[model samples]
Target chain A: MSAPLFNLRGVAAIFSAEMARTRRTLLQSVVTPVLTTALYFVVFGSAIGSHMREVGGVAYGAFIVPGLIMLSLLTQSIANASIGIYFPKFTGTVYEILTAPLSAIEIVVGYVGAAAAKSIAIGLIILATAAFFTPLQIDYPAMMALFLVLTAVAFSLFGFIIGIWAKTFEQLNFVPALVITPLTFLGGAFYSIDMLPPFWRTVSLFNPVVYLVSGFRWSFHGAGDVSLTASLGFMTLVIALCLGLLVWIFRTGYRLKP
Target chain B: MPIISIAGVAKSYGSFTALHDIDLDIERGEIFALLGPNGAGKTTLISIVCGAVSMTRGAVRVDGADILRDYRATRRKIGLVPQEIALDIFSTVWNTVSFSRSLFGKPKDNAHIERLLRDLALWEKRDNKIIELSGGMKRRVMIAKALAHEPDILFLDEPTAGVDVELRRDMWGLVRRLRENGVTIILTTHYIEEAEEMADRVGFMKGGRLVLVEEKTALMRKLGKRRLVLTLAEPLAALPAELDGWHVELESGGSQISYAMSDGAEKGAAQIIQRLGEAGVHIKDMAMTESSLEQIFVDLVGAAAGSQP
Candidate 1:
C-alpha cells in the first residue's frame, strides 16, 4: 500500500543533474585538479626523487603517491558536494528540491553520491597521472578501492553539511580553504608522520586527515602511521558521525527550511 | 472531501508568528485566489501546504493524505510555482521540465512535456538554457515545469508579479484552461483584478490571519460598499457640522465629496443627500462606483491595521 516508498526517479534526477553540472565545469572540477596533481608529482616525484632515498622501505616518489591521491580525494570530495548543494541554495533552486517528492535520504544520496563518484573518478585519474612519474603498486587492490570509496563518501557527507550550514559563498569556502586543506597538508599528505618528532607524531594523530591518509596509504603499501585496524575503524566511526549529523539536519530542517 | 484541507494550521518562527489558525478547505477544480499584501502569511500558507515549511501547530491534508506522514503522496499530487524564480539556470527549459516530472517518479512523457511547453509558449525556447531565457520566458518555463508532472492541484504563489501585461493575460488563459482540465488551482496574488478575473472563490488574509473566504460573486454582493462622488459647484473650505454623521470625505482640492454608502446600489445615498441639503451644500454632478475586491481587501486589512496599536 505504501507503493514502494523510495523514489529512484527523484534520486536519478538529482544525481544526473549534479553529474551534468560537474561535466559542464569539467575544467574547474576535474581537469584542473588532475593537472594540479600532475604538477605535484613532477615537483615531489621526479625533481625531489633524484636526491631523496627510500623512506618507509618504498621509493620516495612511490611512497608519497597514495598520500597525494588521498589529499586530492578528500579536498575534491568535500568541494564537489559542498558546492553541489550550496549552488542550489544560492540560486534559490533548493526550493524545488525541497518541494519535490524526494525523501531526505534520497536527496542526500543523490547529491553526495554523485559528488563521491566524481571524486573517486578524479582520484583515480590523479593516481594514473602519478604512474607516469613513478611506479605504483597496490598490495590490497580491493581494499584500496574500498577505502577510496569510504573516504570519498565520508568527506562528501561532511561537505554536504557545510553546504547547509554556509550562509554565503565565502562561508562555503572557509572550511575547505582554512580548515581541510591546511589539515590535509599537516596530516602528512607529502611526508610520513614517522619522520616527525615523537611529540609531533602524537599531535598528528589529532588531525582527522592523518587517519584518512594513513588508512588510504595502508591500502596501497600495507603500512601506515596508525594501525590498519585503527584507520579503518576511525573512518567508519567518522562516516557514522557524518551520517548521524545529516539525519539530524534533515529532520530538524536546519538552515534548510523556514 | 475537499481536495486540500488546511485544518487549524499555524506557523510561528521563534517569537514571531507567520500564520495564525488558518483553516481552509479548497475544492477540486476551482480557482482559489488568496489575496493579501506583503507579509500577510499568503506565502507562508502556501509553503506549509507544499511541506516546504513545517507548521508549528495543526495539520494539512492533501487528497486526504497527511502531509507529515505521506509527504511523497501529497507532493506528487501538487505542483508549486513559487513566488521567486526557482529553476536550474544552467539546464535547458526542456530538461528542467522533464527533470521535474521525473522527480515525481512519473514516467518520461515527451508528448506531455511538448504540449505543456506549447501551451506556455515555451516550445521555441525548449532547447534554450534557463539562464539564456528572458524574465518572462523564465516565468513561462517555471509554469511549464510545474505543469509537467500533471499534478491534481497547482499552487501558484504570486505567479505573475512583475510580469508584463501580455504574459499576465497568457497566464490567466493558461490557468483557465487548467481549471477546465479539472486541476485545482490555488493562487496567491496581490492583484485584485487577477482574482476578480479568474477566481471562483476569494480569500483575504491580513496580519498572519485569514480574515474571510467566500465565493467571488457572493463576496462582492455581500460586502461591496459603494462610494458616491459629488462634484460640488464650489470648493468647500471645510466639512459642515451636518456632514459629521455620514462617512464622507472631501478630496481633489475639496471640489469633490465622496461618501461610503451602505450598499452597492447606494440605498443610504438619499439620506446622505438630504443631510447635505440641510447643510446647504450645492452639487454640480454625481456619480456612484461599487467597491471591487481591491477595496474590500484594503478595508479588511485597513480594519485589522486600525485595531492594532
Candidate 2:
C-alpha cells in the first residue's frame, strides 16, 4: 500500500482542537492578559507619566503600550505552546500523533501554527485595548504586522523546544519566568536605550529582545534604538535557529522516543 | 508476505538492554499474542515495531516497507492502543476519536465514527469529556481512537489491565470482530488466560529475548503437565514402603496425596493406585487437572529468571 498522504485535514484536525481549547479557556487566555495590560497602563501611565511626560519622543503611555503588548505576546505564545505539547507528553497522548503518518514538520506546523495564531489574535486585541489609553501611530503598518507574526511564530517555536526539553513541570517555568520576562523588561521596553548611559547602552546590545523592541517600536515612531534592517536580521536569525533546533529534536528523538 | 518482520532487533538504554537480538515474523490476519511478565520487554518490542522507540540495531518491516526509511507507510498500516491512558482529558469522545483518524490521513466519515461509537457502546456518552468518564470508558475511547484510522494491523498493549470483567469481554469481542475484517492483531498481555483464549499463536518473551513462539494448541500439548490427587479413606501419619517408591506427597491433613504427572504419563495414575491398594490404603476419591497456560507462563518466567541471574 502507498504511504498515507499528507493532507490539510491532519493539520486542520490539530489546529481546530487547539483553537477550541483556547475558546474553552477564554477567561485565562484573553481576559487575564488584557486585564494585566490595563493595570500596567494605569500604574506606569500615571506614576511615571507625570514626571517624564514622554519617552522615546512619544507619550509614556504609548511608549509602554508596545512594550507591554510585546511582553504579553511573548509570554502568552510560549505558555500556550509549551503547555500544549508538555501536557500531551505528561498524559502520553503524543504517542498517537508520533505513531501517525504525519511527518515531523507537519506536527510542528500544526502545533506552532496554532500557537502563533492565538498569540497574534491576542496581540491585535491588546493593541485595541491600548488605543483607549494613549494615541497611537504606525509609520510602517505592514512591517509591524510582519514583526508581530514573526515574533509569535519564533517564540512559539522556542516554546516547542522548551516543551520537548523539559522533563518536569518546574523546568517548563524556568525559562519563561527567570529568563524571558526579565529580558523583556530590561531590553528597552519602558525606556529607549539612547536614554541610558553609554555603558548601559552597550550592555543592552547583548540582549536579543532589544532588537525585537527596536524594530517593533520603529514601526510605530518611525525610528528606534536600532536600525530596522538589524532588527529584521535578528528576528530572521532566531526563527532559523528555532527551526534548526526543532529539526535536531525530531532527528534525535530527544525526550520523545523512549 | 508477513505483515511484520523483525530480525536481530535490539534496544539498549545506555548500558541496560531492553530487547536483545529479537527475531520474529507475524503473518497477515493472525492474532499473535506476545505474553510476558512486566519488564520482560514485551512493550519494548511492540514500541520498536510501532516506531515509538528507536532500535539500537537491526530492522523491522511492516507490509514489506522498512520502518525507518518508510516510516509513514509502516505506521499508516498499524494502529496502536498504547498502555497509557493517552487522551486529552478535557476533549469529548467524538472529537478525540475523529481527530485520531485524521492524524493518519484518513478522511472524515461520521458514519464510520458513529458505528465505532455504537460498537464500543459509547454512542450515548459521545458528548462527555474524557475526564468525566470512568476508567473503563476511557479505555474504550483509546480502542476507538486506535481503530479510527482503520489500519491493517493493530497492536493492543495490555488492553485489559485493571479492567472489569464486562469491559474485558467487550474488548475481546471487539478484537475478534476486527480480526474478522482481515486485520492482523498483535497483543501483549501478562494475563496468560487472555493469550490462551484469544491468540492463534503465542510468544513468550523473557529477559529481553524471545524465548518461545508456538501454535497455542501445540505448546499446550507438548509442555502440558497435569497433577493427580488421591483422597485417602483415612488420614495417614506416614506413607507406606510401597508408596515411598513413587513420587507423591501427602497433604490436606494427610488425607490426600498428590503427584505431578508429566506428558505421556497415561498409566501412572492407575499403577500408583494399584500399588496403594496393595499397601492396604483405602482410596476415597481421585481428581486430575491438566496444566494451563498460566502454569506454563510461571514456569517459563521462572526458568528465564534462573538462567539469566
Candidate 3:
C-alpha cells in the first residue's frame, strides 16, 4: 500500500493535545504571564519612568514596550516548548509518539508549532496590557508581526532541543532560568545598548538576544541599536542553527532512543 | 505468511548484550506468548520491533513492510500496549483514546472510539482523568488506546502483570475476541499459565537468547514429566533388588517412594506394584501427577543457566 507523504492527521493530533494541555493549565500558562507583565508595567514603566523621563526621543514608558513584549516572548516560547516535549518524556508517554507513524518533521511541527502559537498569543496579550501604560506605535506593522513569529518559532525549536537533552527535572529548568532570562535582561530590553560605554556596547554585540529585541523595537519605532539587516540576519541564523541541531537530534536519536 | 518476521536481531548496551541473535516468525491471527524470566530480553525484543529502541544488528518486517525503510507503513499496521501505565494524568479517557487514534494517521472516528470504550468497560469513566481511575481502569485505558486505530497486529507486553484475577480474565476474553477479529496478538508474560491457557505457540527466552519455540501442547508432550508417589503402610529401610532396574527414590523418612515416569514407562507402574507385593511391602495409597508448564519453564530456564559459560 502506498503511504501518504505526510501524516497530517498525526501532526494535528499532537498539536491539539498540546493546545488542550495549555487550556487545562490556563491559569498558569496565560494568567501568570499576563499578571507578571502588568506588574512590570507598574514598576518599570510607570514608577521608574517618572524619574528617567525619556530614552532616544521616546517616552521612557513607551520605549520599553517592545522590550517588555520581547522578554515575555523569549521566556514563554522556551518554557512552553520545553515543558511540552519534556513532560511526555518524563511521564513515559512519549513512546506513543516515537512509535507512531510520524516523521521527525511532523513531530517538530506539531510540538514547536503549538509552542510558538502559544507564546505569540501571550506576546499579543502582553502588548494589549502594555497599551494601558503607554501609547504604542508600529512603524512597520507587517515587519513587527514577522519578527514576533520568527522569534517565537526559533526559540521554541531551541526549547525543543533542551527538552530532549534534559535528563532530569532540574536540567529541564536550567537553561531557561539561568541562561535565557539573563541574556534577555542584558540584551537591552530596558534601555538602548548605545547608552552604555563603548566597551560594554562591544561586549553586548555578542548577545544574540540583542538583535531580536533591536529588530522588534525597530519595527515599533523605526529605529534600533543595531541595523535592521543585522537583526534579520541574526534571527535567520538562530533559526537555521536550531533546525540543524534538531535534525541531528532526530537522526541520532540522541537522548530520545537507546 | 507470518505477520511479523525477525532475522538476526540483536541489541546491546555498551558491553552488555540485551538480546542475542533472535529469529522467529509470528503467524497471522495467532496468540504467541513470549515466556522468560526478568532481564531475559523479552521487552527489549518487543521494543526493537515496535521502533522504541534502536537495535545493534538485525532486520524486522511487519506485514511484508521493512520496519526501517517503511517504518511508517509498518508502525501503522501494528499497535503496542506497553508494559508501563504511561499516560497523561490530566487527560480524560475519551481524549486519550481519541488522540491515540488520530496519532496513527486515522481520521476522526468517534463511533469506533466509543465502541472501544464500551467494550473495555470504560464508557462510564470516559470523562474521568487518568489519575482519578483505579490501576485496573488505567490498564483498561491503555488497552483502549492501543486498539483505537484498529491495528492488524497488537503487541501486548505483560498485559496482565499486577492485575487482579477478575480483570485478567476480562482481558483474556478481550484478547481472544481481538484474535477472532483477525488481529494477530503477541504477548510477553511471567505467568506461565497465561501462556498455557491462551497461547497457540510459546517461545522461551533465556539470558538474551531464544532457547525454545513450540506449540503449547507439543512442548508439553515432548518435555513434560510424570511422577508416581506411594505412601508405605510400613516403613522400609531400602528398596529391594527386584526394583533396581527402575528409577525410584525413597523419601519421607522411608515412608514414601517416588517414581519418575520416563519414555515407555507407562507400563512400569503395574510392574513396580507387582514387585512391591512380591517384596512383601504393603501398599497404603498412591497418587500420580504430571509436570505443569510452570515446572517445565523453571527447569528449562534453570538448565539453560547451568549451561552458560
* Reference-based lDDT, each prediction: 0.90, 0.90, 0.94
TM-score of each candidate structure, all chains considered together = 0.92, 0.92, 0.96
Q: Tens digits of per-residue lDDT for model 1 on B1-309?
A: 999999998898999999989999999899999998899999999999987898899989998999988898899888999989988888999999999989888889999999999888889988999989999999998888888889989999998999999999999999999999999999999999999999999999988989889999989878887679998998998888987767789999989999876644355678777877888988899998888888888888898888865
Comparison by lDDT, 2 against 3, better one: 3
What DockQ results do all the predictions give, each relative to the true complex? 0.59, 0.65, 0.83
- Clashing residue pairs found in predicted model 3: none
Error of 1 at B78 (Å): 1.0
- Candidate 3 lDDT over B1-309, as tens digits, reads 799999999998989999999999999999999999999999999999999998899999998889999999999988999999999999999999999999999988999999999999999999999999999999999999999989999999999999999999999999999999999999999999999999999999999999999999889888998889999999889997879978999999999999998777879998998999999998899999888888989999999999889
Which regions of candidate 2 deviate over 4 angstroms?
Answer: A4-7, B227-287
Using DockQ as the measure, what is the rank order of every candidate, best first?
A: 3, 2, 1
RMSD to true structure for each model, in Å: 3.6, 2.8, 1.7
Better of 1 and 2 by DockQ: 2
Q: Worst lDDT window (10 residues) for model 3 chain B?
A: B261-270
